[model samples]
Target: MNEQEESNKKQKTSNESTEFLNFDYEFPLDAANVIPPENSSIPEDLFTFVTDINDIAPEPPLEIVTRINSQRQQQQRQRQQQQNKPIVPPNQGVYTIIVGGKPFRLSWESLKSDGPSNFFIEYFKKKKTRVMQIDRDPDIFELIVRHLRGYYIRSTDDIQNQSLLYDATYFGLNRLKKLLQEYSYLNVGGRVFRLPWTLFQKDGTHNFFTGPLMHSLLSPHTEEGNSPPIYIDRDPDIFADIVNHLRGYTIHIRDEMHRKNLLKDAQYYVLRQLSDKLLTAQQTVAGFGEGSNAEVLLLLQDVRIVNMLPPKVTNLSIPNMLISQDWSLTQIQYKRVKDGTPHTLLVQVSDLCMQIHKSAATVKLMYEMNHADIKKMNSMANMAKATRGVNMEIYIDKYCAITIDDNQVKSIEYCMENDLIDTNWEACTKCDLEDCQMSRLILQRAICGVHLVDNMITLCALRLEAISSRFRLNLKREFLSG
Candidate 1:
């Protein structure tokens, strides 16, 4: 119906042989033949054509058809590629996780704990049985301390081994342990696992964190007064996991506390040897009202503080009789006062005995001491300073005059003046040492003795480890029998 159609109609009419006076001398070809074709090499070309676009709607562009077919092929290929790709697996629960093109690390545990706290307690009991087999390998404690320091301290910080670590272990016994334990405070598994990771070591190996930092519990009680027994919430997984984690001791935070505890306890023993009296609470919670509501009370917080930064300097208080009985050493106690009032603290111990003992005394006194002699004692006097106090320098002197610094000589003379003879100090005269051995002294004790003998702590027989082991063995035997 358009102009093109009208033009085509006119063309058709013009080509047809019609009876009309169209034009004079016009060359008209035959209706059936536009071109002369025999074999028709150009048959298609010979025909003058009138064609439509598509069969369905008159005709369509050749390019459009090709484009549609190509699109369909691309979609098919996309499906095939998806099917060919393989999937990657996932790593289980740990510190790290990844998902949806993003990577993340996760370390979490269920806080809502249920069940008898004793189950974990009992499990801890069972796990401690392993300690019985560990012999007194003094090297282990050093390794443990190194391991702990590796994690606990940075080079930027000067970590006081006695102040931060052993102090917590000897807390109630020496009070420092309790002070340190305050920092060990942690919230675990909903149950408020009130543990003294810093102050008390679980059964003495070096694994402090893995050890039961504290039993997740409140004080024992019942709803009614006359009831024989009572109960609280209960779920086994939390207690079980608690048990499992603690029982399977590791050299992580848990075990580190444990070793620190052993050392702390040993430190206390050293104090006791020095004739220090340990203060004990009456356990009657009159001030706190009823049943030791003070269960897990910060027992050693008020415990006195001392200047433990020294070479056998004693700030621990002692009873006169105890001192007379064990005169080889002394204890001077100080009340811990915050803003002047006494902080409810009272325990006695030799500060940092383990760390001090761990150092090489001969090297400390002879070779290392020479470093200090660079000026006063001459070049020949080798000295190495003590790690505890920065200003504390030791040096061996050729003249034996200045090297035996009056301050050092004063301390030695003061102890010797009071009959402080330790037969074990290789540095001391045999007569002086024999006299010390004859007297009741700190060296007469365990780790102190080891310090004098081999320069190490023999923690194999620490009391807490024995107690925990005993508790565990008893529980296991009871469980088996039941």
Candidate 2:
């Protein structure tokens, strides 16, 4: 009731109004829950019940819902795109081609894109099968696959090239065929000889291209390229002549060296017909000045008769006896002997004096005596006269004759008496020796008769000796006597 109490109440009211103006203002929970003027400064303990609660759920914002709707539209559009897309087969990426009963996996896109592989692509498209069967060798297919993959094929083996050609033709792979056709070019000693395959179709027997030479050139084992050409270890000129012959060109080799080299190549490559032709040509050329009637007298020392035939003979004449020194027939004289006989002789003689003389009719001398053997016989006769105290003389005349019919000897008649052997002895002492001489002469006549009919005759000297022994006389005694 006093003035001082009134003043204090007024002062308190002014301080409270100043504090209300300075504090941050927040909207009331409701108009009824307003703070009372009496309790303007609320106690911190009274608001302890208003603690934060994290468990209560709240509705999503409108912006979040709009974004979720946009995401749903995007998903729907993606699904539509998936449904509208073209259906691709599971095996479309890869193709399985069966060759030689084996599966070969390849890219479908690559097969379809390749020009040569169109046939396979069309076939695969026509048949929707997963596996396509093809009848082809697996090894060849491997090569084809390599070629398809853009690898350069450099195989030069003839067999492999032939196989590849067959496959290429079947598959319509013109590129591979062209490559094979191009292989006919031969690289002989840095010289490029382009020989077409068709050029060798003539006379398949003599054609080097059609025969083993072609096989060697195209052999797959041989590496082929521009840097390292297919090497031929032969004379280039000789090979050129061979190529010319293969190309249906008449090969007239004027150079003897070239001919000799060519002959060697021909023999090596098994070009038998070509070898024969070359030999005949060489023989004709070598015997040009020599008369046609001039006989080829082959005095064979250690040479085989068969080895002296055409091709071998040609080789012999080249570069001065290319075959062997023992086969030298140039030293033998080819002149008609004593009588005016119209016969050219080919005699094969050895130191044993067994003469194989071939003329119009073959005359083979089974037993012949040289001057030394005659002297030996004469000495033996002289020794017999001195030691045995028996005067014995034996002489062999030069001229003798025998008759032959078929392969068997019909008769042996000497041109003169004791033409082969002449002996002077008593009837009883010379009986055995005379019988042996007669038997030996008959055997010699038989051998000559057999040789007359047949070019070759096999006569055993042991059998003749046995026959002579059966006559109660040894063949050695007969030889000593004459």
Candidate 3:
């Protein structure tokens, strides 16, 4: 197809989209509601119940809305606004518009759907372009934009109005300049400013480098003083969405880490038990029972923790690669005693990593001990700076001991026998884990399994953050000095 033909085809599609969505919009009078508090990230154990591919749920519903337009009395005379404001940028419109294939509207709505459109109309009066393309519906855009303006004002007013927070300009939207002038969010020096969807794309997909008015918007998570959910005017529903998404991601990662932890622990239990079993077999060889040498020989064929993932993932078998003279009779004897794999497979434990290995056996590490190892490993993790956080096992095992310094190792292995009820190890509730992690580990007894999960999750978060270039830079000086 030629250029004009392709243009005609594209226009036909655009026209169809516009025709499908156009509708009358009511102008709202009231300001938008300030957002609710931010939510925590997703949990790790959320997908534990799911076992097969059939267990996965379906996709969520997508919002399909219409643009809305309404006429209302002016809030202020148009001439008064023209004198104070700068000329509107070429990229923006005084009223709603369609620029570069995306919808861009400037309408407002009150708490109710049909309310006054006065402030919205007046606000758009002094701008350069005042085009609003007709679409299937106009109400949705008006309402959504009205809410966006309100959020922009609420989140940015402090910085815009020259409060002590003026330096904290990492969250405001860049297109609407008046928000900062009238409200508190400043227009300049904002690090992470969100742009309209229309500006965020070229061919279609969001442009990472050039789309955002400010670079930080694309990288908001690490931006300093970015109270993101607060600034983004996060819906409580979005938190739920985030939790859902995070659970999928975290579960995959957490389950992997946890499985390794559990398997290692399970394997350790199996091996240790098998070691005991081996000791029994050895005693049989030394002791002279009916199956004496036979029992010892039989055990060489027994499956141990060191040999597998688990019954859930896989069931391991004695490798043909391993065999011996005593082992041959042992295999035959073990097969004689059991119909399936040995139960000693789950008895391996970490405390006996050496004993089982030297006995021509293998051991899996304990999860509890592994958690301690992760804490220690993370402390020794390659980092550009020093950091501390709550350790989960320490929380369950030692009451959420805070690591005051890099050398704070005693907290992880604190004796449950001695430390429970010890007044020194408890984490305070106020810090929300953050404050609790920075303080000294006061030994106390308040061990809980859920707290163990939370502490370990907190540990993962800390490990991630400790090496995070952002966190490392923020805490580097102290880390270096110590």
What are the TM-scores, per candidate, against the unseen true structure?
A: 0.17, 0.29, 0.16
Off by over 4 Å in 1: 1-71, 75-207, 210-282, 285-482
Residue 384 of candidate 3: its Cα lDDT?
A: 9
Expressed as tens digits, the lDDT of each residue in 53-149 for candidate 2 is 6434567899999999999999999999887664444434777889999888877655643463556666765565758888889988888777776
Q: Which ten residues in a row have the lowest lDDT in candidate 2?
A: 447-456
Query: Which has the higher TM-score value, candidate number 1 or candidate number 2?
Result: 2
Best candidate per lDDT, number? 2
Steric clashes per prediction: 61, 8, 48
Which tens-of-lDDT digit does each residue in 90-181 have in candidate 3?
32333555533457755333211222223234434454445644332333333335545554323433332232122222213233333332
Superposed on all Cα atoms, the candidates' RMSDs to the truth, in angstroms, are: 26.0, 23.1, 39.2
Q: Rank the candidates by TM-score, best first.
A: 2, 1, 3
- Which residue pairs of candidate 2 clash? 156-218, 156-219, 156-220, 157-218, 157-219, 157-220, 158-218, 158-219
Q: Write the per-residue lDDT of candidate 1 for residues 281-365, one digit (tens) a residue.
A: 2221212243321101111221222411111332322221112222112211122211222222112122111110111212211
Q: Which one wins on TM-score?
A: 2
Candidate 1 RMSD to the correct structure: 26.0
Order the candidates by lDDT, highest first: 2, 3, 1
lDDT (0 to 1) per candidate? 0.27, 0.46, 0.29
TM-score of 1: 0.17
